[model samples]
Target chain A: MRFRVFVSLKPTVLDPQGQTICRALNGMGHNSITDVRQGKYFDISLAEGVAREQAMREIEQIAQDVLANPVIEEYQVELLEE
Target chain B: MRFRVFVSLKPTVLDPQGQTICRALNGMGHNSITDVRQGKYFDISLAEGVAREQAMREIEQIAQDVLANPVIEEYQVELLEE
Candidate 1:
């Protein structure tokens, strides 16, 4: 099975990369773009035989522990049907 | 209105950063993790008054022309209700 995870900075957190991109876009005349926040996306494939519940738990742990900065970022996980 | 965009490399393309993370995870004893692919996520806020359809079209164009490498990556855009 495959799971998709998105890790994003919290709304209160500053995103300099996102700001830089937004500025670049504005410079290019994309005035309609008001704000931009950047994040990370991950596609994870799990080996067979792992129970769904176990996978979810493990994924949550992996997401929090390895993929995202707990103090500044949040993560969402979704199982993808294959 | 807000939109979320995810840009990912096509499966045919190799992802070294993802591989490096996967290797690190495996080294940390997360053996159930089979494969990992990494990508970019963007949260875009569009200024008020742009029609949904126009926003969608402009977002598609921006995604293709600026946010992603069309030759190697694909992107998905979703509108988020505020």
Candidate 2:
């Protein structure tokens, strides 16, 4: 099984790195961009024979416990088709 | 207008950070995880009155020229509905 995990900062949090990117883009003349928030993602592959239900359960747990810092970040998981 | 941009290393590129994360997870007892590839994403908000076509054009350029290191990374852009 494979999953895509996206981890982003809570909307309320400040994102300096994203701001820097925005500034760089504007400087490059792509001024239409007003704001940018950067985040992390993971493409995860599991061992074969893992059941879908169990894969979902474990992937969610991995996302919540290992991939994200729940205090300021939120994560979403998407199971991929074979 | 808003867009989501995902940037990931080319499949052939080495991803040490993702490997470290995988090792950590395995060491922490989540042994089912076989591999992990990490990437970056951007949530971009554009100024009002920017047409969808232009937003798409400009966001793609920004992603291609600035957000991703095209030599080793690839990026995808998705227009988002408010």
Candidate 3:
């Protein structure tokens, strides 16, 4: 199975990096780029036969405990077809 | 249409962040975590009726001109069905 994990700052969090990018974009005349949000991506190719449910459960745990700070971050998990 | 762009360091590049994570993972006993890589993700929602090819070409330009350091980074683009 393949999984793609996106971990991003919550909307309420102050994103200095994103702000910088937004300012740069506006300066570059891409005024339509109203907002910029920065995030991390993890692409994992797991061993075959790993059940989807088990993978989800483990990934959820990783997201909550290791990949993100629950107070300021949110995560999305996608199970991709192999 | 929606698009997801992934910008990652080339395998030949020295990834200090990934090295640190690898060491940390090893310390945490995830010995199977032989390698670690870090990357950035951009999720973009475009205006309706945009042609996929146009969007892809624009994104490729952005990836090459703005989001990625062609010398050390590589990118992948995926058009997500809305």
Fnat of every candidate, listed in order: 0.90, 0.94, 0.25
Worst window of 10 by summed lDDT in candidate 2 chain A: A73-82
Alpha carbon lDDT of each predicted model: 0.91, 0.91, 0.71
Q: List, residue by residue over A27-62, the lDDT tens digit for candidate 1.
A: 988899999999998999989999999999888999
Q: Model 3, which residues run further than 4 Å from truth?
A: A1-3, A44-56, A79-82, B45-53, B80-82
Provide the clashing-pair count of each candidate structure: 0, 0, 0
Error of 2 at A79 (Å): 0.8
Q: How well is each residue in B23-81 modelled by candidate 1, as lDDT tens digits?
A: 88889988999899999988899899988998899888899999999899999999886
lDDT of 2 by residue, A1-82 (tens): 8899999999999999999988988898888889999999999999998889998999899999888999999999998753
- DockQ for all models: 0.89, 0.89, 0.35
> Residue pairs in steric clash, candidate 1?
none
lDDT of 1: 0.91
Model 1, position A60: C-alpha lDDT score = 92
Give each model a TM-score. 0.94, 0.94, 0.74
Question: What is the docking quality class of candidate 1?
Answer: high
Task: Please write out the lDDT profile of model 3 over residues B1-82, one tens digit for every residue.
Answer: 6667789999899988867865775686544344556789776555566677876776677667888889999988877554
User: Residue-wise lDDT of candidate 2 within B1-82, one digit each (tens)?
Assistant: 8899999999999999999999998999989999999999999999999888878888888888888999999999998864
List per-model TM-scores for chain B.
0.95, 0.95, 0.90
